[model samples]
Target: MTTETTPKPQHPPLEPATEGQVLSGAEILVQSLMRAGVDVAFGYPGGAIMDTFHFLNRSPIEFILSRHEQGATHMADGYARVTGKAGVVIVTSGPGATNTITGIATANMDSVPLVVITGQVPTTMVGNDAFQEADVVGITRPISKHNYLINDVRDVARVVREAFHIATTGRPGPVVIDFPKDVQQAQTAFHWPESVDIRGYRPDRLEKKISPSHPMVQKAAKAIMRAKRPVLYVGGGAVIAGASEEVTALARRCQIPVTTTLTGLGAFPEDDPLSLQMLGMHGTEYANYAVDQCDTIIAVGARFDDRVTGKIAEFMPQCECVIHIDIDPSSISKNIQVDIPITGDAKACLAALLELVEPTERSEWAEQVLAWKKHHPLREEFGDDEIHPQRVISAIDEIAGPDKITVTDVGQHQMWACHFITHLRPRSWLSSGGLGTMGYGLPAAIGAKVAAPDRAVWCISGDGGIQMNMQEMTTAALNEIAVKVAVLNNQYLGMVRQWQQLFYGRNYSYTCLRRRSICEKVCRDPGSGKCQAYLPNIVAMAEACGWQAQRVERRAGIRDAIQWAEETPGPVLLEFSVHREDNVWPMIPAGQGVKKMMRGMELI
Candidate 1:
């Protein structure tokens, strides 16, 4: 059955307002958000932004008061990733605006659309370095797709509208509009422009559909038809362009196997036979081997980042041709050079290629990939005593199925979740890909659940990473958001420990979460008699935060814990005490080629 892709909802052209209808800048800002189809915003209130909050409280739009500015920004990012709408954020200047920098960088790196409105000090205090003032525009210019400082009250509506347009168009990313305190109080004639006409900014023109007769599309199609061992390498851009169906259709039509990056997890259903799960570091061994052996790589909407292309010169050494399709022209040939580059919307370019490409078979190559899958499958053999992290991820997939959204923090747990969880639909998997932000899981899950109330949202985080933004538990509790959080409590910074053990001769260093300043400098591994007691009980902390919490120490209780959390009405936290030394496998160590993957005890 073919699933029809829903086109992104466009804000209707603003209706002309009668001449000389005056409104405060804050009121105009609120009106502009409503016109942009934004029904909700995530932010924290502060003195500088109080004027906007006062009007927001009276408006129909819901304002979620996150526990921190960073959390608010992440929430907005999660909402945007799932809904294909520009997520909105409002925060005060100085620290409040600075606090959002990490989240802004995260969104910009992942190409998530967000419109952040920051409240600056009064225009009169611009150069005086006034209290609670910040140079937000200057600080965020490098990180954001675009940014503006509103000097005049009349520019509020126009700036707000253009912010959304820029955020959601082209290579989508964060946009900031710093509004001064005096401007928020100033009166402005609310003249909503019928259309935005930003000079030299024409993403709409670039998004035009390419016909199958286009020379580039024909070239890509011809290349694919001629290849014996072709691999379809996809990325987050495919998900953003809503080209999953096209990707799958092309893969099936050409008998090309599909391998995705970490950010491309849900772009193609992992359960499909031709799907190679994920490729790169921590990717399936078979997928990496397939890419290593493939003759041609049809890369769609994917930039070959370092994590994906470890030791770039040696990556895909056997590949003879590369056909890259992307909407952003700059991303093409930015990393690995391509033989055929088709620049346009991923969906459009893919559709055009599908029309021109002919169906074929590569039974020998498919068999080779399958043989590798059978030889080095993704599986962990844990003794009957311990709870493996992979089991927790698999159980969640089994209980929640593929329809629910899974958000993850960066670490071993993130890789485990990515490797084991079954993602059947686009937007079902959300993670901090490029920035690899540690504390992104819980807040992002909160935003995902808020944007999609009916869909179940699960947060998979590690013991080390979860604490980074665990304060958001209060936001979830206060808002009564039923986001299920599973903390893979390994009592160590598992990923770093893995690297330390393998490369640094087990000098664990600062990777142990239970280490204390007073403890002996040379601490042994857990159960080595020198280890101290686990610090700061996670379950107790969750209970203190007003969450329905539990601790699962054994493998047998994994399913029950997940079911209990799922059945709980409000926010729930499950601290699974997993084996401390377990490492994510099928990993190509940093700076190594994909062909040199180590799995299971091979690393040891």
Candidate 2:
């Protein structure tokens, strides 16, 4: 027995080598990020984050110096969105972090995984109202899945690991990590954790809380199986869950016609035989009509936003039953009551539904939808205006082609882009869909380009909205991102003007923003809530930022400029001087149902 024990192999020395040195907190942070497989970051440099950015600059990761912190976060968001990885954003304290709040909230609302790292005031200055100090943790608490404020340098590695894990797992959303200025400067014997251990932060990667046999899922599955005319409505969640393949599979298997919400644009091929145009406020008439006619509505990872449902009580009146499949339980029956509710991750739920659904032909339903599409094809109301917003967008579509990521700012141009552009690929269209943020497009486009460097990115923005975050045009030039800026310069907040035209008898309060100051500077009253005196020559601004800039006043030139911009290697700006009175027609009146949809050149 003693012989069998055998001499234990000579143990190697566990002591540290005499020449070993402790790593700095900044080094530890970057090393941990490297361990997590992070290859890129987007941010603007600031005083608070000097040390961290210094270390990051010396590291292997590629850092994009954005024109604004918000743009940085959004670029990170777009990157995360396209790659199915967590987006990383590093910003300084106070206004820097605050600027990124919109991006964080956007990710949160869209359920996109993002990790925002911000530098705080020094540890010694805690609670002293120090310079550039903002309570980032408190500001982002409700918007983020969770947030952490680092107090010690040793916790940097653990916090980052936990932050990344929390961001990427489960119902993915943004997470914030605020590190004090002193923490980044401090040195420590940093040991990156092999794994993270967080209690009460479990993400359900397996089937646990919900099941296939569960009452809700069973009811939903049965309703879907029995429905004669069923329409599948999808949302951003499908894309976030990486369920695009499954969604396409399920739709094709059942031969069901598919339509999407604005956020759902890239989830399915708009050019598919079974695809209907996106539905809702700015959605196509055909899509709305299909919703009105469908006997049953199958909502997958979609919330019945007012924009989509119109008046909820009056929406889809012909539908006798509803089946809702969503990860968030609250969304199950919050608006239109659900006949069957299946609560699970969209990707998982769709996979299960695919397995349960017997492949059957919905040829009749598909034929009806096709008929609707033929009857209500999307068309430009404006006639032969080469510089018209719609025409410009159509040309951009032609030049950029599909599969390129397109972002839009909030205004008439946004709606026009949504209406005119045909999205035939998943995660190709990114916009401030829910928030409708004005300064969203330029920065978002810059971010999107950074995220998908291989894909051409276009920023479809209004003259008014593009200037909001137009400072980031420099970012595009600096990074050589080659993002094409197609400015739909209607010189007004287009959508609001449409509402005014329809609801207020064309009073046109404060929407007009044109100014030449030839006779007198016709600046809209700044405090009148109509417009402001901040309008600038965006072409000149773009040129100043090292981008090739051209203004398209002629209709024919719109397409030419678009083609040239898309083909050019570096950043280019194509401005379309559009008509102000133009409106996106086939207008569905407020408080009206889909049945009451206004179609094709109707005199209101």
Candidate 3:
């Protein structure tokens, strides 16, 4: 499905400011958001943005006051990732705007749609280092999909519309609009444009695209016909384009196996026999082996990143030709050279391929892939005395069932969730995949809950990553959002500590959370000394934030705790005391190849 028919309900436009009537620029800005069909916004107010915040007092659009500007933007990002509408964020100047850069870049890197509105000093004082003023447009230019500095009040509607258009169209990404204080204070007549028209941007063609009967698509078909081992490498674009049905249909018709990237987790059904699950760094053993052995690989809406494609030359050595389909023309073949590149929407390109592609017998290839999967299953040694994080993830997956969403923070736990949990639908697995931003899970899960209140939203975060935005616990509690948060507390920054143990020798250094001043300065292998006390007491902090908190020390109680959280009315925090030294497996070290993937301490 395209954005035109995407399932995310576009909020109906609220009553706009009366036509041909004069209003303050701040009021006009608020009216513009209403007219643009923005039912919700996430932000924090400050000196520079007081006017807009003041006008928001009477607007019908709902606003979420975040604890920080970065958290606000991340909320918007999560809102956008699941809902088809562009997420909206409003923040004050200087530090507020700078804080949004991380969230904006996170969305940009993942191609998630968001429109960030930041307050700026008066146009006359743009470069004078005015109080709370920063070059927001300049700082965000390289990271954002597009950015604008509104100098005049009259340009507000046009710019906001264009920002949404650029953000939600082909190859979606975050767009920033720097609103000046003076412009917000200026009076102007409000008018909402019926459509957006921007030169040099023609993403409309993607929607207008017909089922590709072109030579390029036909060539891709021929490649599929010729290959005995063909794999469908799906990505976030497949999710963004709502092309799961098309991708699934195409894969099934040809009986080809599917392998996805982290961001592309739910693009194809993981339970399907054809699925190789994830296929890169921290990917499954069979998936990596499949890619290494396949003769043809078809990438949909996926950029062949270094994370997905390890040391390009060694990525798909057995693959004869590459077929890549994406909406962004520049992304096609920009990273990995494409033999048959189709630059269009994933749904459209794929729908067309289904018409021409012929079904062939791949039972032998499929059987081989299944044999590899059976041989190298994703499993962890769980001691009866210690909690296994993988079992916790699997428990959540089983208890939550299929009608839920799973979000994760970046860590060993994130990879564990990917390995153990199963997601059968798009927008169900939300994570900071491209940017790998920590502290994203909590606020993002809150935003996702706000978007789909009926579904159970589970947020899994590391002890370290959760603290980065744990302040949002108040945002969730005050709003009474039923988002279940699971903090896998291992007492150390697990991923980094693993790296320190692996490549940097056994120097634990400052990675230990329970380290005392009396401990060794470098804290060599401090993880060995298991401490009963976890610093900062996440349960106490969460309960203080008006949430139901439970701490589970035994692996046997994981399900009961999660069930208790699900039954609880408001936000719940379940902190599981897990093994500190567990590391993510099947990792391909940076600048290495798939051939160098390590399953444990040694290369497979």
**RMSD after Cα superposition, model 3:** 6.9
* TM-score (C-alpha, index-matched) for candidate 1: 0.96
Candidate 3 per-residue lDDT, tens place, 323-384, comes to: 99988888888988889988898888888999998778888998999999999988766546
**How do the predictions measure up, each by TM-score?**
0.96, 0.90, 0.96
What is the TM-score (0 to 1) of candidate 3? Answer: 0.96
Candidate 2 per-residue lDDT, tens place, 424-521, comes to 87778887777767887887787677778888888888877887777788888877888888888777778887787678766666666643344234
Candidate scoring better on TM-score of 2 and 3: 3
Query: Scored by CA lDDT, what does every candidate get?
Result: 0.89, 0.79, 0.89
What is candidate 2's local distance difference test score?
0.79
What digit string (tens of lDDT, one per residue) describes model 1 on residues 1-604?
9988999965453343444678888878887788788888999988888888767876667889998999999999989988989989999999999999999999999999999999999999987999988899999999999999999998998899899989998889999999998999999788887789999788777667588988888888888999989999999999999999999999898888999988888899888889899888888888888888889999988999998889988999999999999888899999999889888889989998889888898899889888888888888666566899999999999998768999999999999998899878899899999999989889999999999999999999999888999899999999988899999998899999989878888888888888888876766554364677887788898899899999999888999999999888999999999888888887898989965678765655
RMSD of each: 7.6, 8.7, 6.9
User: Ten-residue segment with the worst summed lDDT in candidate 3?
Assistant: 524-533
Q: Number of clashes in every candidate structure? A: 0, 5, 0
RMSD of model 1 against the true structure: 7.6
Judging by TM-score, tell me the better candidate of 1 and 2. Answer: 1
Cα miss at 288, model 3 (Å)? Answer: 0.5
